[model samples]
Target: MKTYRYLDLITALFVVVLIVSNVASTKVVLLGPFTFDGGTILFPLAYIFGDVLTEVYGYKRSRRVIWTGFFLLMLAALTFGLVNLLPTPADPQSQGTAQAFSTILGLVPRIVLGSLVAYWVGEFVNSFILAKLKIATQGRWLWVRTIGSTLVGQGLDTGIFLLIAFYGVWDNSLLWTVFVSNYVFKVGVEVLFTPVTYAVVGFLKRREGEDYYDRDTDFNPFALGR
Candidate 1:
């Protein structure tokens, strides 16, 4: 296996974003017209990280990073769940803390499963689309690839996650509102960060001497290959 100067760093950051997003998702918030989980603000960055990883390191490397995040997130969820199940101290000062902790970090099986499935599917779709577009366009326009892939990826991500996580628990209207709002917000983040993405992609390519195109690469998400 070959190593790059910053691939590890980028992968670390990517996993951090994913784990934090999962933890933050416990809160539902309304920001103006948008009703979404607190994670909405941070989850978009995970997609951006996906774009950069696929663009600079190729889909193979990005796939590995995605799996890394997946397993780590599952581990985090399990850890939280176990901690939430433990009996609290009997002291007066800590009496209510257990309930608060459970309220915030207690794992809901449906939500955790939904998040994992949605992320797995959505990220692969995003990486696959961007890689294909890069080849088709001969790498002419970065914005087209980034924004276009995100439009589709985030749509499936937002819809699947919300439906699975909230279908029975939330009213139909609320579900639709969240799906639309989250989709728009995520795509908006991609568009807003296009310039920054360009800068980072260009810098990484030059410095790391890698601008991977998946012309001969495997698209299998399970194949962690070199």
Candidate 2:
């Protein structure tokens, strides 16, 4: 029953990033030589937030935030699907914007399922591993836990999401290429942002007087009881 000044703010930011990432995933874009879904640019920041959450607050709090994200994502996908299903009014000259709405906001069932599943799994894994590493390292070497957890978490996330979202829909070689690109890029972001992560974690730990250790935490993704 502990409270932190910034936990709510952090969780809100995490949810916002996740929702935006989903919205942006509709377009495959080329950035320089790399071709990736638009989400690829914004998606990795969720992991950075994930690291910050677990690192500062511990696994149990992070688990609640992860489940919060999962529920919100599911609700978003559900709402988008229902909205897309509504009938568009008929007009002879109407360049129907309904179709455009559908194209933009409609959820692909497979991709939605993949995204929710991958996000739930990957975030929990990231939180759990970071919590464990915090204890193992005796709370030293913040970079190790952040980057190490991202390496594993983002790997699972990118691979599982791409496989489910694009395996049959995309060319085989392109699928693997995108998978590799996504994974490498996500992990790379964690490395590049390590200093930022350290600064945030340090500030939160000091301000909130909570550098929690999850030694006795349940680590259950489904159990959100507080």
Q: Mind giving the per-residue lDDT tens digits that candidate 2 earns over 1-226?
A: 8878999999999999999999998988887767778898999999999999988888888888888899999999999999898776787433377778788888789999889989988999999999999999999998989888998999899888988888889999999888887887778888998888888988999999988888888887777784
TM-score of every model versus the real structure: 0.97, 0.96
Q: Kindly report which residue pairs in candidate 2 clash with one another.
A: none
Report how far residue 31 has shifted in candidate 2, in Å: 0.9
Give candidates' CA RMSD values in order: 1.0, 1.3
In model 1, how large is the Cα lDDT of residue 212? Answer: 91
Q: What is the lDDT of residue 33 in candidate 2?
A: 68
lDDT values for all models: 0.92, 0.88
lDDT of 1 by residue, 1-226 (tens): 7779999999999999999998899998999888889999999999999999999999999999999999999999999989988888898768688878888999699999999999999999999999999999999899999999999999989888988888999999989988988988899999999999999999999999999989998898888855
